[model samples]
Target: MAALSPLKLRVEGMDCGACALKIENAMKRLPGVSDINVSYGQESVALTFDEDRTSALTIKEKIRALGFTPISERKDLVAPRSAPVLSAREPWWRGKKGRLVIFAAAMFGAAFAAAQIEPQWSQWAYSAAAVISIVPFARRAFAGAISGTPFSIETLMSIAAFGAVLIGAAEEAAVVILLFAVGELLETIAAGRARAGIEALIDLVPRVAFRERDGVVERISVDDLALGDIVIVRPGDRVPSDGKILEGFSELDEAPVTGESVPIAKQAGDKVFAGSINTNGELRVEISHVAADNTIARIIHLVEEAQGSKAPMARLIDRFSAWYTPAAMAAAALVIVVPPLVFDADWMTWVYRGLATLLISCPCALVISTPAAIASGLAAGARKGLLIRGGAALEMLGKVRTVAFDKTGTLTLGRPQVTDIVPIVGNEGDVLARAAAVERNTSHPLGIAIVEAATARALDIPASFGGAIAVPGKAVTTRLKDGFASVGSPRYAAEQTAPDESVSRKIVALEEEGKTVVVLLSGKRVEGLLALRDEPREDAAVGIARLNAAGISTVMLTGDNRRTADATAGKLGLVARAELLPEAKLLEIADMKKLGPIAMIGDGINDAPALAAASVGVAMGGGADVALETADAALLRNRVTGVADLIELSQATLGNIWQNIGLALGLKAVFLGTTLFGVTTLWMAILADTGATVLVTANALRLLRLGLSVRHSTERNQ
Candidate 1:
């Protein structure tokens, strides 16, 4: 069997969906090219080929011959994570599209002015303008015909422009050409906007960094910073790389990377992500990730790759455009020949009508409608910390009727916290310090949570004298300088000294409120009992309420005990299924598919299978690599309500695509009727098509506004 290989290439000149369709149709004719997806929004083409019959080089050459430039061909779909080359140094107005528009507009103006001065000189002047303006498209039309697409949009355009000129309708021909130049310029500008939005993300990282070595500070490129190198970030500076703070106390604003607007207080030993702004205090930081692999870099790479996959509607339009031009050309031939030969119409009049029909059937506006909106939607979502994998995923997100979340990390803040500290024999500080000291060296979740709580309170924790002895699922005991200290479950403490009624009631009440209770002991005497639980996030209830308002049902799946799951779910107003293994969660996701499309949000390695099983797998920002890779979308910020934001954005984008389609098809239908009835002229036909192109492009640009307007918090209010 021949191995099928996939290749992706960056297509620089492919600005419109019609161009992508032409390239796709031409490449598919090759022997071993089984499939191809050329995305105009992302400006890239992904194709699968049989290596036994064809090579990647042959494919590249074929694309080059189709009148487009293909660069940076790669076997891997993920492009380099460095800054994207979105624009050239020269200004856009001085580029090829600009120069062509300037020349054509000048000629048109001269022709219009000549008509008033000398009516006889007007036709020649208009003919010259039309001839010069159409030369480039005519050449490309020839190339397209030689390749596989004989009736491409460019070919239709050339025939319409040249036919009008030969028939002595020179004034309309010149107008048609000028309109085309303007339309092409509009498409070029839109292309820049699509790419520029992504470039904005890359601009967040400052180019220079201040590295301090042995107390001497030197400025260097951010890329030069490596692992373990200490860098100094002053107030008002953006953190250059992901690292831990060695010496600093200040409030850091992490709005850029995590989308949290409120600044978080930070001290030494706290971790910081690249692109987050430092609001106050000078900090000494040790670099973690190399420049190319920072969190921001990973996000940009994901967005670029996501743009390569087109939505179902966009794909449908691409295929429709391939055959639509040829069909329209055939219809045009029938209109011209059947009228004069069968109905005895004038030959000259029929010829002019046929030329106008060609312009109406170009399909340029129809083809570009879906992709332009999709590209804008993806860019907008990325800016707000919602990262959908591709257009298909974006479309799917809108249709999801049920959202299943993993409880531990998805609903609640995955870490346990000390909620209540009761003192039976001494003060709260004395009980907490001795408990933290006994657990400082233990590697358990509860032990770590206790130690963190003590550290957070700035309490002194003495080091353990020696190794601690742990009883499985019961208690851990260590010898202090005075005697033995123990921290464990209530039953473990009772073996030493049974709890009285007062202590028993406190433990029971805390347990009823969905907390884990542990007893603190000094020797055989009970000192106090602490209550802990994984607290629900502040936005969990509000996010679920939004989903409920949108008619989406919410549920939680977790491996934690039933009591703990119910406690968290009750507060969030969601249904709960507890103590599920990985396989069980996968089975539950399959069962939920009967309701409708499901979106599974998870954050651990065990959630990979379940994430993949759902209609769309969504990962939390702090998810494991396996879970992140398996998921189709991600909330890059730790906002529970980003799920609602993703759904809303998807619906808005889809609605935009439908509107663009209606305008394109509606204009063609109306103009086709008017031209056949002799109610419109060649210039009017071209003008209407140009008008549709402008409307579709302008409508797609609105998605960028929706993206920019995306809320930082999931609660809808900001």
Candidate 2:
């Protein structure tokens, strides 16, 4: 037995989700193909096949048999996501579609001229024109019928055209065929525009970079870059990968990757992302992430993944159309026989009306409406740095009525400052230096606050900090060169040596003000106390207010003390659940079920449980791997206002989807009424079917403009 080989094939000519589904079904019935994922949004098919049973050549042939062209070579099959190797595109004037349009239009024009020349020869001339145009297409319709889609749009179109000619409406039949051909060309162009909005992301990053290797600068492929390698980004060039600035300074425009149009000044120690244009000055950046893991690649992968999960509305529509097309075919058949057999109406008139009804029955407009809106929504959100994982999450986001936020890293700045230092047995500097020595090597927020304060004051602290040992959830103890030193909570200090009444009073005073106070101990005696507090973000209050205006309740969940949590939440006008452990936070998330659908927004790593427990999990852009990997959605701009923007985008997307659906059905209903009353003709029938399809797809494309409008709003408020 041979192992299964995975292949990604770039497929051309897929105009909508229905086209992808037809191809997917065909591949599934093939003996060797399995785990097939055909994505219309990605314009590609990913599937695994048993090598012994089927080869890639067979897969390509299968795709071709379904009418979608598989790109010609290996590079098209499995190229890098960020590679500049898009499948070669032929000009519209030279492609298969172009020739079809030319032939149909030329034949129609020739037939019309022939009718002008001789009135007696008009019927036969137009008949020949209709047959020539519709016959070639009818063959494909026949193939589709054999493949289980008996009532496909093509089949319906062919039937309508043939029925028109049989009913002695050859003039209308040729014109209808011409209209159909032109209408399909327009649909393809509009669909291509929608797809280009996403595929354009691949063009943001350069394929090569100027790598600095041991004092010699070399221009190399970005794929060759390894972690820790230094690359020099000149003014106007994109940073080749996600990295930290190692040398030089510059203002970088990160709008392409982050949607934050403001250019940020970056120097040594500041981070830079792939595809950000360095506006001014040269920067030497130390690569932090490989090419595959950079920002642009991840965004593309996420959007493609999102495309596979169809929206609920789309699924419902798919079910509706599955039966709707067959029912329409049945109605068309009955329309022809019912009046003629029972009422004894004219056979030609009744048959012509039945042909018009067949044209209206196609359901192509209804089938494509949902995915067009969805794909545009996904592309727009990605452009604005709001990454909704799939259609379900996008829909769910609009329904969220309550948003829960993690305190330390989410609502607050996540950077605490040492507010005050009090001495009990030594000067303030002496106490602070000892505290900083113990905390210099620690990663805790409060501990780093003290160390930062010491460094700001230029304290000559001891090296190695006496090999400090951390007591989880308590303190850090070290055997300093002078004597034993420690900095910890009052509870940990009390266990070592009890503080006097005066010192205890001061500790309680700071705690009452929502400041976190830690005790400094030297040789089992109280040295002094240090106070630290993290402030709420600048946009926290405004973001929460926007949600509240939208009728969404906001709350803060934190592991901090009650006073500290309350102080931060008060600024944002939200309630706070304080002093909760990780498990306690999970319990709180479950208890909030009564308020309706809720979204938990957090730093991604620490609040994974609470996020998972809620209706939707949102991770901040600055969050660690857990947030990006596990959250239902991520706000990649890392601003609190981005939360509001995401919700706004969600509502807009849902609204657009409904409008597209309505347009599809409403137009068909109007034409159905007209055809029955003899108020519509073959021209109107063609317009009703093809017109609705073009209209719905064109309407869905409007969502792509929301990216810029929403982005400008987010930037203005920030």
Q: Rate the local accuracy (lDDT) of all candidates.
A: 0.82, 0.82
Model 2 lDDT tens row, 534-619:
87777788888889989898988876767766766777899988767778878888888676888999988667788889888999
Instruction: State the displacement of the C-alpha of residue 284, model 1, in Å, after optimal TM-score superposition.
Output: 1.5
Please state the error at residue 425 of candidate 1 in Å.
19
Cα error of candidate 1 at position 124, Å:
4.2
Q: After superposing candidate 2 on the true structure, give the runs of residues whose Cα lies further than 4 Å from its correct spot.
A: 72-84, 423-442, 454-505, 518-528, 621-627, 708-718
Candidate 1 has a TM-score of: 0.82
Name the lDDT value of residue 58 in candidate 2.
84
The runs of at least 3 residues in candidate 1 whose Cα sits more than 4 Å from the true structure, single-residue gaps closed, are: 1-12, 25-39, 44-79, 106-118, 418-511, 516-531, 621-630, 708-718
lDDT of each residue in 1-718, candidate 1, tens digit only? 8888888787766888778877877777877887687777667788888988888888887777665667676665443665454445247667666777888889899888988899889889889878887887787787778767788767887888888889888889988888877877777777777777677788888888899998899999999999999999999999998788999888898767656677889889988878889998999999887777777777777788788777898879978886788899999888889999998999879889998988888898998898888888888888777888889999999899999998766777868889999999878988899999999887666788999999999998866788999875578999888789999877677788878999988887887788877899988889998888988777888888889899999999976546666777888999989767678888899999988999998773447788889999888835423323558988866667888888999999999999999999999999999999998888788788878888888898888876634354334474
Residue pairs in collision within model 1: none
